[model samples]
Target: MKLSTRIALWAAAVVPVLVVLAGLLLLPLVGRDLRHQQDARLRDRAAAVLPSVRALVAADTRGRPKVEQNQQRKVVDAALDSGVRVTAEDGTVLLSVGPQPADDRAFPTAPGGPATVRDRGAAWRVLTARVSGTGANGGSGTLWVSEPGGLAGDQTAAVRRRVLLVAAVSAPVSALIGFALAERATAPLRRLSRRAAELDPAAPPTPGTGDGPGGGTNGGTEGGTDVGPGGAPFAAVRSGTAEVDELAAALALLLSRYDEQALRTAQALETARSFSSAASHELRTPLMSLRTNLDVLAAHQDLPPAERAEIVAELRDDHTRLLELLTALGTLARGDLVEVDSFGPVDLAELADAAAADARRRHPGAEITVELPPELRVFGWEPGLRIMLVNLLVNAAVHGRGGPLRADPARVTLRLAPAGPVALLTVDDAGPGVPPGERETVFHRFHRRRDSPGSGLGLTLVAQQAALHRGTVRITEPPTGTGCRVEVHLPLPDAGAPTLRLPARRDWITGGQRGDRRP
Candidate 1:
């Protein structure tokens, strides 16, 4: 049922019951009050005749029998009008009046006190008083007065009827008023319900962020609006309640977040597609060159010694470079796909030591020195950290300029220290440093200095590794003032274990090299 109707029905049903209960409680009190008034009238009449009865008794004691009879007759005559009766204790009737049967009895043995009794079949209310005298001839006597109980009963019944009548009449009118008030109170809720019912979920309203294409003037109706892909617009229904407005605001916020995430996903997909296409195209040229060189060698079963040896060496170097380039590309792709869960606590000093040992074994001719602090802890992926350190050292060893190919030590130093909340790893070389203008470009994918024979992805991988750990890689001039120094600043883990931070934006490296003038 509607709320108003329900309230009305409840009020109608309950009010009459309350009225009836009140009437039931009040009827007895009304009856008692009416009986009190009747009793008072009876008492007043008895007092009036008492003086005359005393005079009659005094005459009887003085031996004036004739005067006593006349006085008794006078008393009896007066007492009849007041419904009273008088009697002596010695079985002598003094005066009798009103309805008193031959066997009708007075109140039993109540001395010196007023008593009451109901007369049988008469609807009368009665009161009795015992009269006492001093002389021997003057004995105790009884005086009785009565009034009709019918008047009190009728008054009580009248009061009960009046109460019932008023209750019956007022019930419907009070219920109608209550229903009207309830309807007025629920008007806002009803309007809100109707507005909600008209809303279509399939075509949700577009949110107005500002004065954009989808946004309109005047804050766009103070409600949500949905703009479909084909430029269709629909207005969301507004509930004027504050809680509903808050809910709508929260929903809009969630939708906007979803849109941003979807856009990022699309951009990442596009980047992957481009990477795959570019890698395939680039690998084709190297593969073709290698194939051509092999074909030429195969055609000559017994070639000139120097020529044959030169061709074989060229083939070996190309093959090695090709393998290195492909490996670097694969590493870069893996870094791109790395999620936050792959990170953990790593000791940068330990990683550096391992990288140094590996590099020394790989390049026995190079001079490598490692200066690491104890337990230089950072949060990052262990494999990525190792790859970054090995690449930095290798890049330095391959590119550092010293004596003519063999005499000078290719001095490389790996140092790690705790700098505030960051673990700083710096790789320094004794070689011609990156040109001031080209330092930033060297971190871009496939970027290389003109004289460097290394694949351009080495520093790019370093950049990616630093980014995954919420860190940064920068090229600073070496402390020796002669060569390049690469510093990676990684955030230290609180529990000495690696924790992943927010994913780094791809533009961290790309944005740094956008305006490069190098070919």
Candidate 2:
């Protein structure tokens, strides 16, 4: 049912019943009031007639018939419309006048105040007054006055019937009024519904889109009054009603989320395509080399021992290179796909120390020293952080042999300290430093020196991991200018606390890491 109709129906049902109940509650009070008024008037009549009644009784006791008849006339005249009855102390009937009970036995014997009595089916208010003389002890009688209850009762019933008619008439009238009011109240909601129904979800309003019909782009929201993202105007949802506005806002938010998800899906697809294309291009040369090596081995089984060993060594190098390339590519893909849930509190000191230890184990002759506190916490994905540190150490092992400025070969130092709120980790190597121009470029994919052994994905992984952790990485000359120092500043857990929040955007493989701070 329509809201207005429901309101009208409810009002019709309830209002009449309420009116009737109010009348019922008032009826008793009104009836009592009527009886009280009748009794007051009856008492007044009794007072006026008492003197005459007393006189008549005294005359009768003295045996004066003329005086008794004169007093009886006076008593009857004073009684008026109320019934009157006079009786002596011995229950001897003295005089009767006006309207009264036909049966004298029905009269109250002892009546001081007004009371209710019935004769036949009619109710009456009766009052009794003692008619005692000041000087004449000859006569003492009870004077009775009575008035019919039906006088007030009839009036009350008439009023009650009229009130009931009014209440009955008010029901449909109230319902019609209620329905009109309800319709007026719900007008905004209907408008909102109509406008919302007209909206096209597919052509959603986006930020910076042109204003369309009604001087606004009809996109994200449901109305024309409010401008949504891209400045598109919503046509109808928010109709100035609080409930409608709130619902419009909720719907807009939901649609906005759906759009964001769609965009993310598209980005994910693009990232996958880029990964496949890059992998194919990079793998072709190595695969060709592998095929050539295999062909040579198969064709020449009787080749000299030294030549065979040399070919085998080259085969091993190619195989190893291919493995490392695939591994680095896989790791980069994982970093790109990493979610926020994989992140947790990692002690930078502990992680750096472990990486330093591993580098020491792998290249014992290469002096690797870690100078850091027992624990400095930062929230990050463990595998990503480990990838960053491992790549740093590996880079130092491969290329950071001591240069002319420092005689020691492959010596590296890692230092960790707090720089305000961020943890600063600097990996210093004792080798010829990276040039100022090439520092940033080294983090780009497939950017490597001609003679570089490993795949060029190592520093790219480092950059991706740093970005993933909402941190920054920079390459600069060390204090002595003998080697390059790569500094990574990760916003630390406040006072050894871990706060894991990933960056807003993550497509490191497809979209390059744009926020790497350079020095």
Candidate 3:
């Protein structure tokens, strides 16, 4: 049943039962009142006739028949509709008129005032009063008045019938009234249900952060209104009912969150597919070379030492290449899959100094210099920053070839300084610098110099980290004009210290580098 109908029915059932119970409670009091009134009337009649009864007793005692007859007639007139009886002091019957008990003994003996007297299948209120004269043996007697209970019983039955009729009639009337009110109350909920049913979570968000039909904007109706308020499913829907609006708002919030998570899930799946495809394509060439070198060594067990040594060296180089390729690919996949939890405040200067130190250890043949404070912090993922810095320093040490003017040991300089709300980093090489046209392409996956001996994904890793940190990287000629300068800029942590977000399109290892250029 509908909620309104159910409520109405409950009220209907309960109201009739309550009326019946009230009737039950009141019926007895009504019946008693009728009986009491009858008793009072009987007592009044008895009082009125006492003087007449005394006169009759006086007349009878003196042996005066004419006076006695007159007194009897007077007593009858006073008693009216009630039965009247008179007796002498010694129990002599003086007068009997109207209704009386079949057996006199069944009446209340000498009833001084109103009293209930029961006989076979009958009931009465009987009142008795003493009659007195001036002297002893002069005039003394008792008068009795009686009224039957049947009159009150009849009236009580009539009242009971009326009470039952009213209870029966009110049941349906109350039910109809209750149902109408309940239906009116629930009308808003039904409207809300319809609107919610029409909501399409997949509907695209409006351009420029405005509210839409199903999307909330900022906090409002997909236009960034108060989605957190009483509008659920869409905070813009208000029905003027607190509970309904609150429920709708809650439901809208849940759906909006679900839609958000759904989009993220779809993006994650696409990134996973790209990672797999790239991994397979890039690993094929190295795997083939490994297989060929292994086969050559296996086929010639007694080959000359020099030839064997050369083959063994080639096999080792292929194995190393496979390792580097897998590591770089794994790192790129991790960057693509990074979540907000992986970020924290990292000291950019400290991170840079550490990266330069590691590079120096890796390349003792080159001279390295680092210039920066010990702690210039920026909100970022420490590991991603470390990866970016390591790549830049390694690239400089390897490719910053003979000094611009003369052959000299490779020299690399790392610098860090704050620029407005951003941290600036620059790595300058003393060797040949990057060409003007190829500066951007070098960050693409697997792009390398023909003579370079490292995996081409190093600079790609650098680009991924920079993008993940909401930072930027670009190549230009160093101040000295000898080698390329890799300059980076990362937003500094504000007073509020909010977390930085990754780029919206982060599939750099899967042909997303086209968006990496400055326009």
- Whose TM-score is higher: candidate 1's or candidate 2's? 2
- Residue-level error in angstroms, candidate 2, position 338: 3.6
lDDT (Cα atoms) of all candidates against the true structure: 0.68, 0.75, 0.76
Candidate 2, poorest ten consecutive residues by summed lDDT: 210-219
lDDT by residue for model 1 over 1-519, one digit each (tens)?
999999888888888888989999999888888877877777777777777676665565555788768877777666655566666666566666665433456333453322345555546666777775335665557666665667788989889899999789768976998799888866755764554455444443333343211122211223465432222332344566566556555544444444334434543575477566656765676678788889988998888999989888888877887888878876776665565578766788898999999999988878899888877776678888999999999998887656555347688988899898888888998877788788877887778777677767888888777765667788878877987899888877676543333342343222233222110
TM-score of each: 0.56, 0.75, 0.65
Consecutive 10-residue window with the lowest summed lDDT within model 3: 207-216
lDDT of 3 at 104: 82
For model 1, name the residue pairs that clash. 205-225, 205-226, 206-225, 206-226, 344-498, 345-497, 345-498, 379-498
Candidate 3 local lDDT, 480-512, one digit each (tens) = 776789988888889785344344345665566
Stretches of candidate 3 exceeding 4 Å from the true structure: 1-250, 253-265, 284-319, 342-353, 371-382, 399-402, 405-456, 466-506, 509-511, 514-519
> Model 2, which residues run further than 4 Å from truth?
2-8, 40-82, 85-105, 159-163, 173-274, 295-315, 363-365, 402-408, 495-501, 513-519
Alpha carbon lDDT at 4, candidate 2: 87
Question: What tens-digit string does per-residue lDDT give for candidate 2 at 177-293?
Answer: 999999998897777666556655556344323221112121233332443334344543446678777776765665555544544455567678877887788888888888887
